[model samples]
Target: MGEFNLPVKQGYGENQKTSCIKCVLWGKVAEAYAPNIKKGDLLVVSGEFYVEEWVSDSGKRLQPTIIVNQIQLAKKSGDKQGQAAPTQPKATEPPVDFDNDLNIPF
Candidate 1:
């Protein structure tokens, strides 16, 4: 497993604040995606989210973590000149057809 800190921004104007979350990527996903990630690159990620608690000299510490299941590169913000988006790693397996798999009707 590989771990990284992802900073997330929320709200707007005076209410805006940035928080960092610890993300954990395991196995194939980490191997295929980690090398290609850059500081300014935008990404779309999905996974399990949870909080982990631990004790420290200061006291108990709580951290939010994500166990990334899927990740894809996204176009950088303000790229109005139509630059091509970053190439993504080829899928190791066929994508799940959620509708069919869950038997949900359109």
Candidate 2:
């Protein structure tokens, strides 16, 4: 059985400048639909992002990019890879704020 509802890991969207269709995100598709993903393909993605908001010399706000952090393919279609590899636990250290909430105002 394919595990669709799974936690997603942080990844970067691989794309270059000067492209007509700016919707080809190249990264690890959120685990939800990764079970049945093709090797390589472009997709229209939407997700929470953080971008640099700056101002030009004319005091005009420059274009801010929507940096995709956690994303998933909106749709999927392909063979049901019954042989989908078993995803293992994240092999890395804990997050930066793993210890405490630290919401107190010092």
Error of 1 at 3 (Å): 1.7
lDDT of 2 by residue, 5-63 (tens): 12233445664333221111222322333443454532333433333456778785533
C-alpha lDDT (0 to 100) for residue 65 of candidate 1: 86
Q: List where candidate 2 sits over 4 angstroms from the true fold.
A: 1-41, 70-106
lDDT of 1 by residue, 1-106 (tens): 5778888999999999999888777656666677767787777777768899999999999999877766777776577856647655566543333333333221
Please give the RMSD to the true structure for each candidate, in Å: 7.0, 12.7
- Which prediction has the highest lDDT against the true structure? 1
Candidates in order, TM-scores: namely 0.73, 0.24
Lowest summed-lDDT stretch of 10 residues in model 1? 97-106
Displacement of residue 54 (Cα, Å) in model 1 is 0.7
